[model samples]
Target chain A: MSTVAGSHFWGPVFALWQRDMIRFLRQKNRIIGALGAPLVFWVLIGSGVGPGFRLPGWPADMTYLAYFFPGTVVLILLFTAVFSTISVIEDRREGFLQGVLVAPVAPEAIVLGKLLGGTTLAVGQALLFCLAAPLAGVPLDAAVLARLLPALFVVGFALTGLGFLVAWPLESTQVFPAIMNVLIMPLWLLSGALFPAAADSWMRYAVAVNPVAYGTAAVRRAFYGDGASMGLVPGYGPALAVSVVFAAVMFALSVWMVRRRRGTV
Target chain B: MTVYPVETDRLRRVFGARVALDDVSFAVREGEVFGLLGPNGGGKTTLFRILSTMLAPSGGAARICSHDVEREAPAVRSCLGVVFQSPSLDPHLTVAENLRYGGNLYGLRGAPLEARMRETAEALRVADRWSERVKTLSGGLQRRVEIAKSLLPRPRVLLMDEPSTGLDPVARVDLWSIIGQLRAESAMTVVLTTHLMDEAARCDRAAILHQGKLLACDTPEALCGMIGADVLTLTGREPDRLAGRVQAEFGWAASVHDGAVRVEVPRAHEQVARIVEAFPGEILAVTAGRPTLEDVFVRLTGERLGEPFFEKAGGRRKRR
Candidate 1:
């Protein structure tokens, strides 16, 4: 059964994670692409709609950029997570992943390695995007940063795990971008990242069920502070608990998916 | 206890309706360079995949160092190092980093892991290329790095699939020399598949497979001896006609292979002159030499190894 065998479990996991980081560092275009799209979205869409767009609970003083700010951070994390996890398909095709598969390491370690790798890249990019918060008119305090960092980690881990689950069984990368469009974009859109869920009464239920909604709310609460107590966004306590549970569930699902399709793929 | 590094009893693998491997049993000793000589689709890869724990057998048992390949795959994997026919290196990483990652999978770290990696790189003569990315290295150097990666774990049995494929003649020779050195120094048991007869001739023992069946298994000398003492090759413009004439005139059974008339004889040197004389100007060239592994393969399979079997099947399928 090779039940991880103590300290050895971390070796391959850490090595694989390190490989992903090295590859990410060498490819500057990937960093630019992952962070650029959401930045463009925050600017173009936030300006296109104009600052006059407002919800009932939002501060009358708020601008569209401030409302779209936290959503852009989540988008950065999601896009980076998706981009990094897609390498699982590439690695399998390139034959490097096969080398790892045939090794004595457990499949759980392989999944953990991939999850950690993708999550780290996503969180790093998300943090970098958060540096532009002052431009969006959101105050960047130490307490807010502390809360935002862990929220980003939980959100990034869950999204990366989701990407891992999708990429593990896939042999080719041709259709993955379509999945990103159909599944990921919709999940992000319905999470109340771009607008208030109360704008559409039925969407509140959808937001309640959407796992990404909790992540979006968690980030929004970190940014909005006392003003985030409105009904539109879930409270920080419930949001963090849900995001943590979602991350844990996705992690387990990623491990299960890898174990189910280990040698077959 | 001296356990056989590999043992399979009637190991069977079926890919849907196609039986890739049928009831085949074999055993490999602790230390010897064994060759699995077969044409493509002859089930050599299926067996190799099973032994490497990449594929499970449909029926029967396969063990490595007495560990069940299916039930105890981790134990089997721990002791088995595999060099796939296709390149398995990450072209993005340097040779040293690749080796370090491979070692990490086996719980190898710290100074001991670094020392072992250095030793393997030195042994394979790839120490100088350690800092170079695998994409920058030549095919031969990449192959040596692959071997070094496998050696990092100090496995008892090394399984390679068509290890010499895509290598030049010089690289092939270099690879065989390393295999020989590994055998002499560490007594490492090597099992590799090769369609090249010259490569098979270097093995301590070789198993010939045809149509998913074991045709013959023995040392190179013994296998050649099964056919005859010598082989007479007659090259002519009309090899089929020359083969017919030789059969009728000399009463020797001659076969046409690869556009050449071939005949097995006890004393080929004495018959070479007679064949040229009998055929006159029809024979462009005549050569008599000791039987090679190719001749032995031809004797068993009645077809050359590595040649496309599909072409032959295409013709048959049209007629049907």
Candidate 2:
């Protein structure tokens, strides 16, 4: 077992992850599709929704575009995560995932490599979407970008891990799109992506419980200073703690599922 | 020199309520082409999956070069290569890129990786089309590239699941030639699963499996010998009635199944001539043939190989 562990733990993981990156790079259309849709949403939706939308605790003068920029970033990350998860089904159907499963690599590495590869792609999309924030009238600062980097990484990692966990039990590709549809919208809405968490007491409670809500809130705080707080609900310290915990839990579950499914191919 | 490159003992696998493989066992001597011959859904792929370390056995164990498939899978994997029944190459990548990526997976890099890629491509006759995208390559060429990718690591055992499924006759011959060369030159143990009779005939030894059971395992000649005679197939307008009449009149051992009458006779050619002469109106076609892997499979399973099962909704037999 140790010999098996040593031989496969790193080599195939790195190789598969690198291959995935290369695949993403080669498909320029997919990158554009992932980044472009969210940019359009941020611009069109933010502008359209900006005039009438105002949160209770948010500064009265804050424009809808500035208020929603952080949410859009989170939305972009969520979209990328969901899409990347759905691609696992495609990979499985294409036989590449099966090839990896049959290789000497450890199951943990398969899960980790897939998550890392997917997280990298998701983060790339998020960063590209972030580039549009300035032009959309959202303020940009070096500190915000620097602070959001680790938060985005954490969120991407968490989402990728969650994606793998969802993908493991699925037997057919047909179920993935439907599952994503059921999952993505609820997770997005409940995460306070469209409105501030402090708007409603119940919503603040719900956001506190939602894993994605913590990630979005953390990202929003990074972007707009303390103005993005959840009021008396929970501080950034607890939210960061919850996000990290959620990531760890999801990652552990994903790894376990991969190991269980490893040789049953 | 008396090494068994691949070995398994009572290997079994269960999926849900179905027993996919049951107490399967075999060994492949170095430099020999070992064939797992079974009908579709007969546990051939399941066996290959376990041997390739893609599936864990529910019972028993297997080893490649003395490394346990379950415990020492990485070491076992390093010493083996597999061509899955499904196309395993990345369709988006160029053939050269796919091969290079495979090489990289096994830790080959720099000059050695490049040299190995060139050698494999040339040997597999895919060198000229190395730069073409895999999706653009013909099915046969894609299979060759897959085989080449497997050969890159110089593995001790090469496990292929139905490797000749989509190849044309000429391509099949080419692939067989490559297998022969690989076995002869590299002394690698080549294990492949195929339901195709001719392909099974090419193997040094073959195992016939049915419904997750290993019915028989031996040299192709020995398997044919077990049936004791050549096969005489008679297709007639009324095959069932004719088969019964022929059986009653000549006291010949025969069976009517799959729209054909199968007779085992000492000299099938002479018997076929006599049957054709006697039953002129009834017989549409009379052909004498040697006992093939299909015959061996039928004899073992009590069912015709590749016959469509009418029992279930998704019962269509997959082609090899």
Candidate 3:
């Protein structure tokens, strides 16, 4: 059977991916750290902005708490994604990844497995964050749940792939906090997660080029339903298309990095 | 089938201006316990990495079962099982879980994978520790589980990098006995790298590496036979001065090494008493014994195995 031979490729991918999942579940601090901080940020900053404050493109009735809800969800996903991918640096430093690198699996399978593992963690955290939507005055109905989950998954995959690329060449996790400060914080800030982008603001231009912007916009569209969006963000069709393309490209980049010259590692 | 389970043809690897492996070529016959013996930074790890398909050679090629390590990595990987110097098992995972994961990487699953895991665990004497997390196990026990995990795939060849590293003497003995038992039971072809002279002596055949070059490759006894009949070791604080005096006065070529003066002679027992009598208080202790693997390394490379080269600052100490 072709499947029998093909399992050589996918089998290792599944094993590596499953190993990450098991490690994530076993570590209690990871779960708390991944979910706890974003929840705190959402509550503190959301209420601090007050309900009456409105952006140029926000719906009149939407509170600052409601506006910050989807951004906090994206924050959870980013934290979990970074946390999961950081294990790659650990794997290399501790010699675990060398075992996988020597296996019969293709490099593409390795990249896909790690991306999926990180996506699984990110999406899990995102789901937990989603439960608090009502606190932000957003609905938790089936219609919202259905659209929000898929959009989060796509965003998770893209973000995790991006994280994998960043983490692959790094030999230590000590530099991650600095990297997160310089790269990750800016990515979320410009993605229209904290504030709505206006047509004339420079942020609108930055949002247009940011993949996370499309991801956050997709979630916002899902949260508000048809005709409820600020009209400042890209349409649902374009956001989803751009995000999927971003994910595919980031995945391909990760695969290339792994398959690069043998000496770099 | 290839005559050699492992073979390399002029394999070379370079890190910028430094060459890690330089024109190293050798072969390990099927079912043989082969050792790559070298000091730290002597290119054993580079060669191991190339054979295990982790690092591509900068020039020439290495093959496992006639498949090039670089061009046919998957095929080469399927035949080789590698146990690294550092711990590779996830500390959070149980022995059983680690074995299961290893089997899955080789495409084994379900009952067959479980059976192999149990078989290997029982053989390595880690079956009782299967449910314990790896972090809870001692270094020796973790290494046993690591060996068990690699065996789950039933690879034709096993390559271990510094297998006895960080093990107590008792644990080191236990590890070697396990390797002997595994080879006898399964006819496994085992290749291991080590810096310990005693460890290299246990191999059926061994290769000596120094500064990225192959010094010699032969059976342990054969390599030792390259040295003279006996080795006389003199331990003292001023070994370099003592060695120079021994060479100048006694006309014997003595070398200072590892805080000791070593001289290879035809009859060390006869020479040791004369040396002690001649030097008096200059020599702290003197011992004479048959030649071993370290003697062979010193004979070939003019330096003892595993000694730090830069620490030979005896010349400067005297001037000061």
Candidate 4:
């Protein structure tokens, strides 16, 4: 019944993606919570740590503000992903998702549409953060923008897919916000974002196991360019590989969750 | 390979230890209005979910338009339109926006999608409310938009779950009229589940369900015919005692409905006088009329249907 090739897949995905983008642009509170709060945190934490902040293996010349800059970008992506995927719970309660579930689209189409929507919003917010990288001594040119945007997309897609996985089967926003805070908050703290993956401590193993940490390492590598080596995963290639794997796993899990419909939609 | 629009063979579903649907089986003819009729917790919802391809049967099979609902869901989906018990519109989006999104989800786009949207909206009578946000519309208006959304794909079978749950009296009348219009105009099989007896009465045929079992299936008139030609009701202080006395006095199986002794009689008007005359002072009031679908239900199962009736039917197929 489809006119264009692959429209059966892309059509629904586009509808869901456009829906989230329109909602994000129209709601000032969503934009503020996703973008504004992270910018404020970047300023406060980056300044509070000051030039006095230095790790053993890192350069003493690098200020903590420059050190925490990538963390702020990751934080922005997380907040926007959370903001966008919260609607999944709302959609379940409101019955919109049920309508989509009964449609002629595949489960992968539903997962992709929802994940891509959140990824779009999260990356959009993080792009706003990239404009201020110059304040933290990070250069901001077309080449930097080109490299940084895709890196933000990778981090955002992984985070948003994670959110969609958690949010799909949930019936309400009550426990979901708590899950984001209690469960995901720790993954962020260990993500090399705070203190360079803590060389020889128990935290080094914790950071090694966290999929989110690889994402932070990737954004760091992309933002700083060639030879930047203090990221938790060490190399850009390895970090990107791990982050891509995490993103794929999360996306796959969400699709499986949507398809496992023995009891409900 | 039966040529029915929809069919289920020995279908069953269990939620842990509780059986939501027993070995239920039925078939729907083309362009007919069929209803799954029962009270709350009667398993109609579970059956509706299976046929709509939203849930799998724990055992047996369901086919829609000759395609298996579970194994060939995508093929079945193209032939099906489903209206859920709950509202499915995005409140922030306008009616046109909701319909367009619905069309897109089914792979329709561009000029044909726009033409179909306009046609469906006009047919559902929501054309004037095209620009209004769904949240801003009245409940009845919102319901029209919902039906409009489902019809965009031109489905061959329309499955509705409690289609009139929240509608007011006037809106419900409009809703039934719309269903009637569709039946007269298109060759679409419409199946719905409802606890409302009047709604069941309106259907061309109905399947009476209770406690995961199919109690009876036939046209409403045929099902009602199971209760005699007329109903004879007598109310008094002691209804259970009166019911027993009725069975003894006349060989009719009398049932008590809401503290009234209800008996199905061949000639209710003739019997009502005979009953009052025989009972004398014990009969406070007497009334006679044709048996309704509710009367059929109460006769076959009993009102409030309580645990006593369920315990009896639990052991055997009540229809047999």
Candidate 5:
């Protein structure tokens, strides 16, 4: 099965990780665009729709701005971390990835490298959005931010893994915009990030099914504890559990996609 | 036993009903440049993929430096360096950054990696271009840097898949010169795949593959010697018709290949004038020369190596 033979694993992984970081840093426009669009959405939508956008069975005191803050964090994670995986398609097109495919390292090393790199970027951007937590009426502090870090990281990791899964076998990113619409956009929109999953609707089933819903719910729980529609998606403990499982499964699928053993790709 | 740098034992691969490779067996000796000479879809790519560990053979086995390409793939990969037809360098990264990452993947680091990169770049005549981004380098220069990057780990065998695919004539010449220099400077074995007959001639030994079958494998000189006669190629607008007429009139067997009629005969230079005169303006030009690797491949397969793939497919469909 081509299990990693030696200490050779980490070197290649680190090389890939460092290269992604370099690319992320070099493209300053990407930083502005990825973070800026989400921030603008949160400000415009949360401010314009304030107080009137309450679903049945929600906390009465929760304002739209506070309710959508974690959603904005997840949105930034989706754009910064998940979209960064499009580089895999670019790598294949540029012929850079074919070199790595033939390298001595196992394919798991590649999955880990890409996952860690994307997760780091996404989580970093999400954490930056945490500076706006006080605007959402959530008490922002060191302890709460600490809780937010791990949840944000787990959710970001899962999202990046999802990106890797899609990008692994693709030769070109020509259809990625279509995929962003059909797949990524739906995942976020239906994740109860915009609306409570616990409310009676046909999409509640979809929210219950989507792993990202639990991820969003977990992040929201970290933001406001038990008050912000905690039972709407699966509460904090069950939501975090699903997010962990989701991340693991996504990573496994990505590794299997490129492993030389089965040679399926 | 002297372990050959590359070896395949009855190697076979199949995609559904079509066998891409069939019972191919050969061993490339150490310190010599070996070539897998074949046309596109002639199983050269399938074989290259198997050896490079990008794909697995459905049956039989292949090895690199005595390690099984399938079972010991990681070990095999560690000792093997590969140059693909595509550029592996990141266009945004400078030549030096690319080399650094390339070496890091092989677990080479620090001063040793720097020394190796400089030494290999110097050997490849690309030492001065270290700071240039790969996208800024000419196609020829990028190929040199690609080779330099592969050599940083000092792999025992360097394998290339159609390394000259997109090069211009001058770049092709430059590539061969770099290959020759690499051979001269080190005992490392080099193996490359090529469909070009002239490129095959530059190899120490060439293996001719046609339609998933290994026709022959030997030194280029010895392969040419298999067809020990002068070859005359007659260019004309209608090679199929010309080949038929040459056989009907001259009573000498002639075949059509790549828009030319080819004939093998003793004293071909003398016969060329008589044939051209007999055909009168029908024959546009005639060139007589010693049999090349192309002639050897033609002799072994009875079909031209450069025949369009659709022609073979059409033949198959007709038979079906």
Candidate 6:
């Protein structure tokens, strides 16, 4: 009987994921916005900031554009992850969330299904942003691409989990956009997504505490062949470990928050 | 006889200082259409939400098919189907897809899920338009699809919240007919909430709720009988003065409320002459009719049925 119940759990998960994917495909404009915003940042902001700064600890002769490209990839993850929480609020208003909440599946599975669906869309956006890096004069190799996949997955999971955590307490969509502006922008700026982390010790300490900073570091390691330029502290191992742990913790918190809120309502 | 499909004991749900549901308890028998009749914010929706396992009660307990909602939520959820007041379908998906998703949630797959989908579509009269996107469908058709989705799992019990709110009159009749047929065929227990007296009259049994408390529970005929006599409503310029005169002269039970004068009259046609003779002002209109569920509700709560007290022009009943 337990085995039968376990088998039933995957049915709803697949259905939810498929439904989201189909919706994403149907809304071409949303897909474009998700993928296009990072490219604009790469061209407009990267050029404006490129000439004025030098990446710390990078080998000589490396272009500033090279340093900024990885940051742009992480930026895609940051923006998409934060905005995805709005979908949760939308779901709530539309009563779709209540439908799923009443399902027989565990709350954890429901959270996981939503996270996976949102992360898949974010990953697609991030990959589209990654494809433009070489055209902007950043070099890419097979080794880099190989490492980038896992890094992107970790980043996606972390951002999606964070989105779920933030969406839990929200009752309406009107408050979410304002909350995202207040929360995500500072996290992105402090995470070396636009500049090197070692510019100031205080800033470096702040980035060390930021979960997305680990994701940035991991992405930088995947893209540049060296992770030292991404942050003051080098090494993809610690960054990957931190991101994975953060994702797990946030995902658990999101599940618990949903359950707790369900109890109250 | 089969056991009760749904039973709750002193179910209470509190949000902060407000009590959404206050010690509410009721049971629904198999194959019976049970109505939770109440005005808006009267805890009918809250009770439905708790029974569907979407919201937990702060106190008391509920069971579906003998499975406790809190302890065995999974089993309860599986045993029951819910059609929320708000439309829950994805506007992006087709009718078929929506039904398929609902079926999948109940552990249905393969031929069984497909067969259920087909059966529900036919039963709901939406089989011809299964491929149409829900957004393109009319409100009535969309509601039919929602009903079809709820029926996909072949649940032992079905819970609906104001299912006819957005439906047209003809559509509502058709939907109720479908519900009656479905209950007759499957013997599934149905618990629905509505403020429509005509809809409530169709139910096998109904519980009238006002201010999060059960005012009365019984069949429609029994409820109307509790009011004793037919209702005689007289509207005129000086309703209060006229009501006082009528009450004094005839020594009849009469009350002036909600802009109308209600009198318990055995023979309303005969009483009309006495009323016209006793009152000084000209009567604008006089309505004599059989006491309905609305009268029963108004008699118990001292408020108009269906119209929420919170929405009255002046501050009326204080929120508990």
Count of backbone clashes for each model? 0, 1, 0, 0, 0, 0
Residue pair clashes in candidate 3: none
Residue A173, model 3, lDDT = 92
In order, the Cα lDDT scores of the candidates are 0.85, 0.79, 0.85, 0.83, 0.85, 0.79
Q: Residues B1-320, candidate 1, lDDT per residue (tens digit)?
A: 66788888888889789888888788888798899998776788888888888777889999988988887777777888889876678888899999999999888888999999998999999999989999899989999999999889999999998898889989988998899899999968999988778888999999987777888888999998897578999999998988998899888899988898999888899987777787679999989999999899888878976455635544322200
Q: Per-residue alpha-carbon lDDT of model 6 for A36-134, expressed as tens digits?
A: 787777778867765656555665555667767877887787667666666787777766777777767667667777888888888888887777777
- Native contacts kept (model 1): 0.47
List per-model TM-scores for chain B: 0.95, 0.93, 0.92, 0.91, 0.92, 0.93
For A169-252, candidate 4 gives per-residue lDDT tens digits of: 777798976898888878888898777765668988988999888888878877777565463456766877888889999998
Would you list the clashing residue pairs of candidate 1?
A: none
Evaluation by DockQ, superior candidate among 3 and 6 = 3
Please, what is the TM-score per model? Answer: 0.94, 0.91, 0.93, 0.93, 0.92, 0.93
Cα deviation of A59, candidate 6, in Å? 1.1
- Per-residue CA lDDT of model 5 for A68-118, tens digit only, reads 888888999998876799999888899898788777877788889889999
lDDT of 2 by residue, B192-288 (tens): 9987777888999998887899988999999998988889988988888988989987888788768899888878887766788887788888889
The residue pairs found clashing in candidate 5 are none
Candidate 1, lDDT over the whole model: 0.85
CAPRI class of candidate 6: medium
Q: Candidate 5 regions off by >4 Å?
A: A1-3, A53-59, A199-205, A226-238, A260-265, B236-250, B276-282, B307-320
CAPRI quality of model 4:
medium
In candidate 3, what are the lDDT values of residues B247-309, reduced to their tens digit? 999888888777899888898899877988898899899999999998888888888775464
Ranking by DockQ: 4, 3, 6, 5, 1, 2
Give the per-residue Cα lDDT of candidate 1 at A161: 91
lDDT of 1 by residue, A1-265 (tens): 2363222468889999999998888778999899999989999998898856766766777788888898899999999998899999889877787678678887778888988999999999998888889887888889899889889999999999989888888889999989999998999999888887784689989998999999998998888774554566878778989999999999889877766555422
Instruction: Provide the lDDT at B100 for model 3.
Output: 92
Output the better candidate (2/4) by lDDT: 4
